[model samples]
Target: MRIALIYPPPWKIAAREETVSYGHDGPPPGHRPQDLDADFYQTPYGLFTLGAEALRAGHRVKVLNLSAYAWSRVEEVIAGLDADVFGMSCWTANRRGVALTARCIREHHPKAHIVVGGPHATPLATEMLEHHPEIDTVSLGESDATFLELLGRLELGKPTSGIAGTVYREGDAIRKGPERRAIHDLDTLASPHTYFDTHIVMTSRGCPWACTFCGAETTWGRGFRGHSVRYVLDALERVLARLPVKMLQIKDDTFTTNKKRVLELCHGIRERGLQFFWSCDTRVDLLTEPLLREMRLAGCQRLSLGVESGSQAILDAIDKKITPDEILESTEMAKRVGIKVRYYMMLGNRGETRHTFQETLDFLDRARPHEYIFSCLSIYPGTRDFHDAEAAGFVDREVFFTETFQELKTPFDASEEDTHRMNEWFFANSGLRIVHRDGVADYRAILERLGDYHAAHMDLGAALYHAGDLEGAEHHVRRALELGYPLPGLVHNHLACIAHARGDLDGMMNHFSHAAKVDPQHFVLIQNVNAARAWFKQGGPGRKLPLQLTVRHDFQLLERTVQPTLPGPLPEDWKAWNAIALPAEPSATYLRTPDVEGSQHVLKTRTRLKVVV
Candidate 1:
């Protein structure tokens, strides 16, 4: 069977000037600036897992990342696709897009089966089926085994109903089957890194705590389950080999939930000689000084903490289970070990007052994390906030089907006065705020903990260069290059700046040329190269003036080569396999089945189809 898994855009984005052909023989898509949201444009990692599962079973699969495509391009791609089943990832931010895309698929291929699943669809499966007839089935929660089984049933012309972890439409009634058990052993499933070259990797699933605004517990169940250290290291090695820039985001719910497991994983990474910079999200309370040091030595460049609120009252109300003191201590400890600390702050939760708001701001000033980003509370389905709001009649399920908002982003139970104040402050300081810069002393402390590591040496060298220690900076920067630092362009760019500091124009030009030749994909190197070209074009060599240089390494890489991360081309007789009967055995070890037959409550409402032009 031919399966197409799509990552839909949040909404219909307007066209932009940039265009690129996305592994299709047609006119390229107009890449819009709105599609550049790092959070939204990133193809969800689950689709890759599903594609791998299908391909392993000798099926043809196409994983298309239409997350950044304009509406016209999405239509063209959807129309061109020839598949028996269509799988789409739905999130609170892109719920409408999922519906729109499902409708488009039904219009083009009336017989194709449509399946939707994600954090949003897992909880609101029945409502989704009732509102949008375009969606045929909704796969609920950790759907690796469930998805493969459903595909087998579809191929054999079997009913989608009576399958574990699925709710399907049969005529006019929506029937849900038995609840699918959580996969006891994650390693039993195929690893996504084996097939796709994505920078995102999840080493674990589920969080122990149920933060009010989060739906992690809803999707990943009540406890944390991590992949074995060996499994993770293997995934890392495979992904690292394919990436041009050896940087990854370990996107787990709570990465450091198992401190011992993390320590062992870190040791394994070092033992295997896997060199890459990574960042992970975790709670501040789960961290310790020793663990932070070990993680930094193992190439943990940044640690993002879910410090929802700095006010103890607000934290307690949200069941955050951590005090403001813990947040401060964790931030200081991570900074002490040279790991850049980024706090994920929130604007509004259960209880919000003027005093509490002020407390958050004051706490931020005291904590002084390297970076912080704040977002308003969004009441997602299956979350504590969502259920509580529904029971209190504060929000109706119909709002999700009616409201055009990207997310239900509103202050939960905040007073009107407090809401106004928070919104004003949020709009003013919403994006990532870089509050702290590492000085020479800070870098020295970092280097002491992570000795001779390429990244640490480069960071300390940059700090030394800024502090006017040209000789010391040159020695460390050269040392970093000798240690086989991945991005030599950054090292040579630093050398160019150092030479420019002195009166060595020839050395500066030579270093810049070497940087451009080695790795011109980094934005910083590109900026310096463009500046040099313009300067020489204007006869800078003959002028008696100093050329200004910008020396910075933000670890951002421009993707020069775009390899299509999809399954190989199918054989001519591949479709004939679908007609062959095959047993659908459970892939992973099952824990237990829950009662999810659910009340047959169907909402008699029409879904409003609106696309933002």
Candidate 2:
């Protein structure tokens, strides 16, 4: 039977009931989904997993990531693909959007069975099926085997409610079926990489640690089960042979949780002589110098560490089980071996206070990771923190069910307003962003949220320019300069590129000079810098002042004295170096010997110029 797997648009949440407002042009007020690169959405790995399994079982499967597509386009796309089953994977935030999508698919393909699964649906299996009439089934826990079996039974036109780890609607009542055992041998699962963009290789399933704020352990259980070394290598080989993916992210809760396995994987990769730049995340306490070194040799480009907080009390409170010293050592080891470190930090966790925040800042000052993303502590369903928060009357499951991701609120000493302000301050002071989708908000929010901050506006401007919005690009870039966006040099460099594009030599030279004064390190800026320096020696470009120079060719002037400079403002040190060309076949030639200044710039060419200015 034909199956359609969907990664819903940004707006949907799995628990989205019949009565919530989500189909508006924008996301719900005070709510934004944490997308990782909004411009290009990652393939929903869960959908890929289920789809791959379904495909392998001799069932036809079609998958779509509707995150990047506009909400209106969703219906148009879904209507075209006819399938027997419509399956969607959603996060808690996208619960409303998933329900909306389900409604759309239902309207078009009413005969198709709708199955919703993911972190959001897995927890509230009964609640989701009951609340959302559009939903036919909610897959709970591990769905790879469960879904495969469910689809087979459905193809045979049988009842689905009795399927393990699944909740389905029957006779106006929501009922859950038998619990399916977690797949102990993860290698039996098909490689989802062949189906979608990201080769999100989950080397292992389940996290042993019971971090209070995280809901991972709840969903996958506490036992850490990993695919064998050969299984992993074989999976990678399959993906590489079938597709052209240069990078593979080994998405394990803690990649190095099994040190011997990691070493073996690294060694296996090297033995096969297969190389690809990859990344993985792990706990700070799990890292060691030797293991990291092996990973580096195996072409690990980035290492993401969860240095959630600096306060020992807060760390212990959250059951992080990682010390500040361990964080530093791990960061140092990763950096020393040339693996760029990315930190995942959470603020406003248990025992969080202004003092703890400052402690985190201090720790960051010492650790100095390459990059980091921050998040306010999230209390998702099935987490210890969630249960405690609920018990304390801080949050209700009904509200959580209705609002989904937006319902999560961090219970910190600081007020919501204060936490938000602190988050911005943390970004400005500590120089770290959050783990959010690098989408339109990510670029526009800097100015809209922070009120004209400079650093990334240039980036936004460039992005706008590339998107054919020349006016918007120019405005943002100009605003960036006005707000003293830390990298003013880039502003001048950008202006130089525009000037160069418009064939304005003086404009290009003037901006290039300003950029060079500010130390042009970026490639384009460096090009303009070098060009400006070469075009004029003492007086910079844009200087309308013309030097009367004569290129005397055997006492005869061979060139014009008046050289036209392009229109725009000139630099302070603009100069015109005039010279006569003297080739090897020429009867007369003039050459300058080395001067006191150790600039050994030889003017060797097809012909050299003799200066008579």
- For each candidate, give its TM-score against the true structure: 0.88, 0.68
Per residue, candidate 2 scores C-alpha lDDT tens digits across 470-524 of 5677687888688644345567776666665555778867876786676443344
Best by TM-score: 1
Candidate 1, residues 315-336, lDDT tens digits: the string is 9999999999999999999988
What overall lDDT goes with each candidate model? 0.78, 0.64
In candidate 2, residue 158 scores what lDDT? 87
Candidate 1 yields a Cα-based lDDT of 0.78
For residue 281, model 2's alpha carbon misses the true position, in angstroms, by 0.4
Query: lDDT of candidate 2?
Result: 0.64
